[model samples]
Target: MLKKPTSAYVHIPFCTQICYYCDFSKVFIKNQPVDDYLEALIREIKAYEIRDLRTLYIGGGTPTAITARQLDYLLSHLTEQINLDMLEEFTIEANPGDLTEDKIAVLKDSAVNRVSLGVQTFNDRHLKQIGRSHNEAQIYSTIDSLKTAGFHNISIDLIYALPRQTMADVEENVKKALALDIPHLSLYSLILEHHTVFMNKMRRGKLNLPTEDLEAEMFEYIIQQMEANGFEHYEISNFTKPGFESRHNLMYWDNDEYFGCGAGASGYINGMRYRNRGPIQHYLKAIRETNHARLSEEVLTKNEQMEEEFFLGLRKKSGVSVKRFEQKFGLSFDDQYGQVVKELRAEGLLSEDKDFIRMTKKGLFLGDTVAEKFILG
Candidate 1:
C-alpha cells in the first residue's frame, strides 16, 4: 500500500451555485449525496498507508458549503491519520457565505488552521455577473468572524480582468482587500475556460473581457497594490504577509509528491500521476467495490517531469535553483535544457543567477509563451 500522502487534498464537489468561469469538478443539485460522498471518501482514506503526511487541503466546489454534519463526518475520519498539532499547514477552502459562525467554529475546533476564502470580488455588480452568492457585507462578516474565531492565518481570493472590468474597478477591489489587512491574498485573472458558462457567454457575444493590455495592467496593478500593502508576490497569483505563505500550495509548485482522495482528486507519488473519477456516483461506486477511487493514471517521463518542474518552479518569484533541478533529475540543467534556456535568456524572458534560473517580470507576464519554450516536445 502507498504510504500516507505527504500532503492530502480532499475534493468536496458540491456547490450551491456554479460560478460562470468555474471548470472544476462540481455538482449543483437541489438535494445531493453529501453523506454518501463522505462514506466513500473515508473508504479511500483508509485505503492508503499513513506515513509522513504533513499537509492537508480541503478544497471544493465549496467545502464550507457542505452541511456541518457532513463536515463532522469527514474531519473526524481524516484526523485518524493526520496529526493536526504537527501538520505544517491544513487549509480549507471556504466561501464568504458558507463560513457562518457555526461553520467557522467547526473548522477551528478541528485541525484546520487556515482558511482560503473565495471572496472573488467586493463589487456587487461584478459578483452578480460572475454568479457569486456573496456580497461585500458577507466578505466583511466572514473575515471578522474568522478573525474573531482566532483564525489568524487567513487567505482571501480575488479575481481581476472580469468582463467589462475597468482599471478603477481593479484598484477599488484592491483597496477593499487591503482594508481587511489579511495575511494572504490570491489574485487571479478571469480565465474563460472552454466548458464553462463564461466561455459560452463569450461565444454567444454576451461577454466582453478586457483587452490583453488591460488585463496585463490589472496583473501589474495587483502586484503593486499587494506590495504596497506589505504583501510579497512570492508566486504568480499569490501574495502573502511576511512569514505566512501557503505551505500546501508551495508543495504543488515545487512538484513534491502528495496523496489525494475524494472524487476527481489527483495524486502524485514516486513518479506516478493519477486522477480520480469526476462523477460523484461513479467514484462512490468504485470506492465501494474496490476500496479505492481512480480514473486515470500516467507515469511521467524524465523530460516531461522536467518541463513540469521548470514551469511550476518559475511560478515562484524566487525561481528554481539549477543545483536543485540537477539534484532531482540527475542531469545538469545546462546540459539538458541548455539551448532553450539560452534562447529564453537571450530574449530577456528568463534570467540566471549564481545557482538558480527564474522568469523575469516580462517572462512572468508572458508565462504561457515562456512555459511552452521549456517543453521538450
Candidate 2:
C-alpha cells in the first residue's frame, strides 16, 4: 500500500482583489456562496480518514480575505479532522491589508503558527502596478500585529524583475525586507503566465520587463544580500533563518504525497496526483454528489516518479541523495542517470559527494536546464 500523506494543502480560492500576474483558481468574494462553500469544504475534509498530519498549509487566492467568523468556521472544522498536537507546522497565506485584528485573533486562538504574507514589493508604485492592494505601510502594520499576536514564524514574499523595475528598486525592496527582520522570505522573479494581464501586456509590447542579464543580476544580488543578512538560501526562491525553513514546502520538494483539499486544490495520494475542479460551483456539485471533487487523476509510472524525484529534490540546497534514489527505485542511481549526471558535472553544473548529487552555484541559475537532463529516454 502507498504511504499515507502526512501533509495537507487547502486552497481558499477567494480574493478581495486579484493580482495582475496571478492565474490561480480564484474568484472575487462577492455574490458567491461563501457559507455553502465552507460547508462543502468541511464535508470533503471529513470524507478522508482522520489521521495525524505533520504539516498543513492553507494557501490562497488569499485565505485571510474572508470575515473572521468564516475563517473561524473553516479552522474549527479543519482541526476536527486532524489532531493539532501532531501538526508541526500550520500555515495560512494572507494579504497584508486583509489581516484585520479580528482575523489575527482568530489565527492566534487556533493552531496556526506560521503566516505567509503577500508583500510582493516594498515599492508602492510597483505594488499598484501589480494590482496588489496593500501598501508598504500596511505591510509594516500587519507584521507588527502578527508579532503582537505571538506569531514569530512569519514569512513574506517579494517579486523582482517587475515591469520597468530597476536594480535600485530591488535593492530598496531587499533593504526594507531585511529591516523587517522577519524569519523567512521568498523572492521570486516575475513570470508572465497565460491569461494574466501581464502576459497580455507583454504580447502587445506594453510591458517592459528587465533584460535577461539584468534579471540575472537582480537574482544574484538577492542571493548575496540575503546571505549577508544571515538568511540561508535553502531553495531557489526561498530564504530562511536558522530552523525557520518552510516545512510544508519541503514536503513538496521531498516528493512526498499530500492531501490537497478545497476547490482547485491538487493532491497526491496512493501514487496518484489529482486536481479538483477549479470552478466553485463545479467543485461544490462534485463534492456534494460524491464526497470528492477530483477533476483529473493520474497514477505516476515508475520512470515518471523517478524523474519527479530528481526534478523536485534538485531544488534544495542539499540536492538529491544517491542512496535514497537507489533505495526508492530499486536501481542504482548511477546506472539510471550516469550519462546525464556525467554531462551536467562535466559542464560544471552539478557536483556529487558520496551521499548526494547537488547543483553547483552556476547550476542554481540554470536549474531548469539541469533538471530537464534527468529525464530518461
Candidate 3:
C-alpha cells in the first residue's frame, strides 16, 4: 500500500519584476512559454493522481502576474478533480497591484480562500529601493478590493532590518501592517543571500544595513506589538489571529510529507525528498517525456530524519511533541537528546513540560543556532 500526502504546493515561477533580496527560483514573465509551462505543470500533477487534499498552495515568483485567463485556466484544472469538501485551504500568492478586478473575479469564482500579498514595507521609498513593483497606496487599495470581493483570509509578508532602516521606520511599518486588519502576518528580517542584489552591494561596501543590536530591537518590538494587538506568535516568523494559522505551512513545520509540483518545486513522499527541474525548458521537456520533472531525489536516513524533526519542529512556539517524536521514530526522546536538552535548559535556552520541549524567548532570538545544537552528527 502507498500513502499519499494530503497537502500539495504548486509553484509559478514568473514575476513581473525582480526584487533585490529575493533568490527564489523565478524569472521575468515576459516572452516566456506561460501556457506551455502551465500545461506541463498540470500534466505532472495529474501523473500524481491526486484526488483528495487537505490543502493546496500556489506560490510564486508571483502567481497573479499571469493573465486573468491563465489564472482561471490553472485554477479550474487544478481543482477540477480535487475533493473540495476535504480541502481545508486553497492559497494563492499575489502582488499588491496585480490583483485587478478581472483577476479578483477569477479568484472569487475559484476555490482559493486565502491571499498572501508581498507588501514587504509600507514606505514608498523603501518599496522602490527593494525593487518591488507596487507602492504603499497600491497595497491599501488591493486589500480593500480583496475584502470588498468577500475574501478576507489574508496574509502579508513584511521584511525588517532592511538596508539603512531605522527603529522608527520599523515602528511605522508595524503600525501600518496592523491597520490593514489582515488575519495573518509573516515578518522576516533581511538576510543577504548569495547571488542577490543586496549581497552584491554588501560585498562592495555599498549596502547600509542595521546593526545586530538594532535588528534585535526591531524583532522584540514586532513581537511585543503583534501580541498587544491580539495576534498569536504561533511560529517564529508567523502571527495569526486565533484560528487563522496557515495549515499548509503547519504541515511543513510538523514534518509531514507533501507533494511539490512544477519547476524548481520540492516534495517529500515515500520517505524520499525530491526537487524538479528548475529551468522552464528542461522541466517542460522532462514532463513531456515522462510526465514528471524530478531533477534530484534523496532517501533520508533515520538519523537524518530525526535531525530534521528537531530542526523544523523547533521553529514553532509549541515546539516538538516528545510523545509524537517517540511514537514516530520508536526511540525515547530523552534517551537520545536528554543531555543536550538539559544543557540548554541550564543555559536558559530551552524549557520543557511533560509532553513538549520549547525554545524560550532568549533561545528564539538566536533561532537556528539553538536548533543546530540538536544535530546528532
Candidate 4:
C-alpha cells in the first residue's frame, strides 16, 4: 500500500464574478445550493478520515465569495478533527474586494496562516478588460488591511503580456508589486483557454495579445527584476524570499501525493489519480449517496511515473536529483536518460553536476521542450 499523504487541497467553486480568462469549474454565487454543497463537501471530507496534514490549501472560484458564517463553519469543521498543532501551513485563495473584515476575522481565528490574493494586475483599465471586479485601489487597500491584520505571509498573482499590454506596463506592475513589500509573487503570461471569452475573441481576431518574442522578453525582465530585488527564482513561475516559499505548492512541484476534496478537485493517492465531479449538484449528489464524489481514476504505470518526476521536478531551479531518481524507481538514471541529457547539455539547455541535473539559462526558457525529451515512451 502507498503511504498516506501529508498534504490536502480543497476547492470552493463559487465566484462572485467570472474572469474572461478563467476556465476553472465554478459558478456565479447566486441562487446555488451553497449551504447544501458546503455540508456535503464536509461530509465527503469526513469520510476520508484525515487525522493530520502538514499543508492544506483552499483554492477556488473564490473561497471568500461565501459569507462570513459559512467561512467560519467550513474552516471550523475542516480542522476540528485534524491535529492543528501538526498542520504547518493552511492557505486560502481570495480576491482583493472579497476579503471583508468579518471574513478576515474568521481566517485569523482559524489555523490558516497564508493568503493568496488574485490581484491579476495593478492596471485598472486592464482589470475591466479581463472582467475582474476588483480595481487597483482595492488591491492596495486589501493588502494594507491584510498587513494590518498581521498576515505577513501573503502572495499575489500577476499576469503579464496581456491584451494590449506593453513592456512599460509590466515594468510598472513589477515596481508596484515590489512596493507592496510582500514576500511572494507569481508572474504568468496570459494564456487563452478553450471555452473562455479570450479564446473566442482570438478566433475572431478581436484579441490583441503580445507576440511570442515579446512575451519571452517580459519573462526575462521579470526574472531580472525579482532577482535584483532579492527574491529567489525558486520555480519557473514563482519568486520568493529566503524562508517564504509556498510549502503547499512545493508539494506539487515535488511530485508528492495529496488529498483533493470538493467539487472539481483532483487527488492522487495509493498510486491512483482521481477527479471529483465538477458540477455542484453532481458533486453534492455523489457525496449524498456514496459519501465520495470521485468521477474517474487512473493507475499510472512505472514509465508514466518516471516521466512525471522529470516533467514536474524540472520546474524547480534545483531540478532533479540523479540519486533520488534511482532510489525511487530502482533504475539507473544515467543509463535510462543519459543520452537525452547529453543532447540537451550539448544544446546549452541543461547542466549536470555530481548531485542534480538542472536547467541552464537557455533551458529554463524552453522548459517544456526540454522536459518532453525525457518521456520514456
Candidate 5:
C-alpha cells in the first residue's frame, strides 16, 4: 500500500502582474472569477478525506495577491479540513507589494507560521527589468511588517544570473539578504523556461545572461556567503538556520507523496503522480462536475520508482541512505548502481560514508548531469 501523504500543496494561480521569467500556471488577477475559483478550490480540497497534515504550503503565482477577505476565506476553509494544530509548518508565498497589513493579519489569525517572499533581487533596476512589480523598498517594508506581526520563520527567494546581472550585483543582493537576518533563504539561478518573456528575448538576442562559468561563480558565492551567515546548505538551492529548514519542501526532496490542490497543482498519491487542470475555467468546471480537477495521472513502474528515489534523494545534502534504499526496493544500492556510483566517485562527484552516499560540492553544481546517470531506461 502507498503511504498516506502528510504534506499538501495548494496553488494560487493569480498574480497582479506576470513576471518576465515566470512560466507557472498563472493569470493576471483582473477580471478573473476569483470567488468561483476559491469555491472550486475548496470543493477540490473537500474531495479528499480530511486528515491532519504535517506541512501545508500555499504557493502561487502569488497567494498574497488576493484580498484580505479572500485569504481569510481560503485559510478558514483549509484549516477546517486539515487540523491546524497538527501542522508542523504552514507556508504561504507572497509577493512584496501584495502583502498588505490586512492580509498579514489574516495570515496571523490563521495557522500560517511561515512566509516566503519572492524578493528575487534587491536591485530595483534588476527588479524592474525582470517585470517584478515590487521595488527594494517594498521588500524591506514587507519583511518589517511580517516580523512586526510575530512571523519570524520567514524566508525569501533570490535569483542570480539574470540578464545583465554582474558579480557586483550578486554581491549586493547577498549582502542585503544577509542583513535581513531571515531564518531561511532559497537562491536560484535564472532559468529561461519556454513561453517566458525572457526566452523570447533570448531568441531575439535581447537578453544577455551571465555565462556558465559566471553563473557557477555566483552559485559558489551564495553558498559561501550563506554558510558564513550561519545558514546550513540543507538542499541544493535552500539554506536555513539549524531548525528553520522548510519542512514542506523537505517532503518533496525526500520523495514523499503529497496532495496537490488548486489549478495546475501536481500531487503524488497511491504511487501515482497527477496534475490538475491549468486553465481556471477548466479547473473550475472539472471540480464542479466531478469534485476533482485532475488533468492527468501517471503510475510509476519499479524502475521508475527507483530512479525517482535516487534522483530526488540525492538532491539533499545528506544524500541517499543505503539502508533506506535497500529496504524500500529490496535491492542493494550497490548492486543496482554499483558501476555508476563507482564512476561518479572516481570523477570526484560522489562520496560514500557509513550509511549515506552524497554528492560533493563539485557534484552539486553538475547535479542534473549526475542525476541523469541513474536513469534505468
Candidate 6:
C-alpha cells in the first residue's frame, strides 16, 4: 500500500498590490475568484486520498486575504480525511492587513496551531519602500490581537537589505520584532528580482542597495542580535525560540514530500517534482478541465538529488547526518562528492562533528556561495 505524504501546502495567490521586490506569483484582483479557486482546490484535494498528512501549511500572497467565512469554508474542505487532532502542526501565512478578529477565531477553531505573519518591517518608511501594506503600529496591534485571541505559536516575517535600509534600520527592525517576543522569525535578505518595479528603478540608476559587503555585515549583525536575544539561528534565514521552530517549513527544508495545491503551487511526490502554471486563468482552467499539471515537471538524477541533500541538509544548525545521507543515496558521502567536501573543509567552510558534515560560521555568512558549491552543474 502507498504511504500518505507527511505534509501539504495550499497557495492562495490573491494580493492587494504586487511588491516591487517580490518574485512570487501573486494577482492583484479587485474581485478575488476565490469561489472558483476553492472549487478547484476541493477537486484537487479529493483526487488525493493521502489522509495521514502530518502538517498542512496554508500560505500565499496571503491566506487571510480571504474573508473569515471563506477560511471556515476552507477548513471544512479537509477536516475529515486528515487527522487534524493528531496533526503535529498546521501553519497559516497571513498578512496583518488581512487578519481580523473573526479570522483568528476561525483559525483557532480549525486547529491551525501556528501562524507565520508577514510583518516585513516595523518602520513605516521602509514598509512603504518595499510596498508592504502594514505599518509598525499595525504589526504591534496584530501581534497583540493574535495573543489575545489565544494564538501564542506565531512567527513574524521580516526583510532587510533594502536600497536605503541601513544598519540602523536593521537594528531598529530587529529590536522592534524581538520586543514582540514572538516564538519564531524569518529574517530575509532582500533580493532584487527581475521585471519588478524595483528592478526597473535599479536599471535606471534610481535605486541602489548597500554593497555586498554591507549586506553581509547586515546578516552578521542580525545573527549576533538574535543570538543575544536567546533566539536560535536554526536555518540560515530563520530564527526561533526553544522548541518553537516551524515544523511545516522544516519539512520543506528537509526535502520531505509535501502536497502543494491551488494556483501556482508545487508538489513533490514519488521522487517526481512538479509545479502548476503560474498564470491564474490557465491554472484555474486546467484544474477544472483535466486533472493535469500545466507547469514543468521532472524527475531528478541521483547526482542531482544527492547534491540537493548536501546543500539543503546543511541549512539546519544540526546539519546533515553522514549516516542518514548514505542511507538515502545508497552510497557513502566520502565515496562521492568527497573531493569538493574536502576542499571546502580545508578552507574552513565546513566542519564535521560526530556524524554530520555542516557549514562553519564563516561559511554560513557566505551561505549563497556555500550552497552553490553543492549544486550539481
Colliding residue pairs in candidate 1: 4-49
Across residues 1-377, which tens digit of lDDT does each residue of candidate 1 receive? 54434888888999998899999989894478888888888888878754456788999888888878778778878887665566888899989888766677788778888999999899999999999988999999988999998998999999999999999999899999998988999999988899999999999999989999999988998898788879999999999998999999999999888888888999897788999999988998999999987788999999889988988999998888888888888987777888988999999999998997889999999986897888888
Question: What ranges in model 5 sit over 4 Å off?
Answer: none
TM-score of 2: 0.99
Candidate 1 residues lying further than 4 Å off, grouped into runs, are: 1-4
- How do all models score by TM-score? 0.97, 0.99, 0.99, 0.99, 0.99, 0.96
Tell me the lDDT of candidate 2: 0.93
Number of colliding residue pairs in each model:
1, 0, 0, 0, 0, 0
List the candidate 6 regions with Cα displacement exceeding 4 Å.
292-294
lDDT of 5 by residue, 1-377 (tens): 54678899999999999999999999999999999999998888888875779999999989999999999999999998987678899999999989999999999999999999999999999999999999999999999999999999999999999999999999999999999989999999998999999999999999999999999999999999999889999999999999999999988978888999999999999889999999999998999899999999999898998888878988899998889889988997878998999999999999999999889999999998999899998
Candidate 4 structure quality by residue, lDDT tens digits, 195-238: 99999999999999999999999999999999999999999999
RMSD of each: 1.4, 0.8, 0.7, 0.8, 0.9, 1.4
Please provide, for model 3 over 52-166, each residue's C-alpha lDDT reduced to its tens digit, 9 standing for 90 to 100.
9999999998999999999999999999868999999999999999999999999999999999999999999999998998999999999999999999999999999999999
Question: C-alpha displacement of 118 in model 3, angstroms?
Answer: 0.4
lDDT on C-alpha atoms for all candidate structures: 0.87, 0.93, 0.95, 0.93, 0.93, 0.83
Error of 3 at 29 (Å): 0.4
Span of 10 residues, lowest total lDDT, candidate 1 = 45-54
The local distance difference test score of model 3 is 0.95
Q: Compared with the true structure, what per-residue lDDT tens digits does model 6 show for residues 60-92?
A: 877788888888888877776587656898888
TM-score-better candidate, 3 vs 6: 3
User: Worst lDDT window (10 residues) for model 5?
Assistant: 43-52
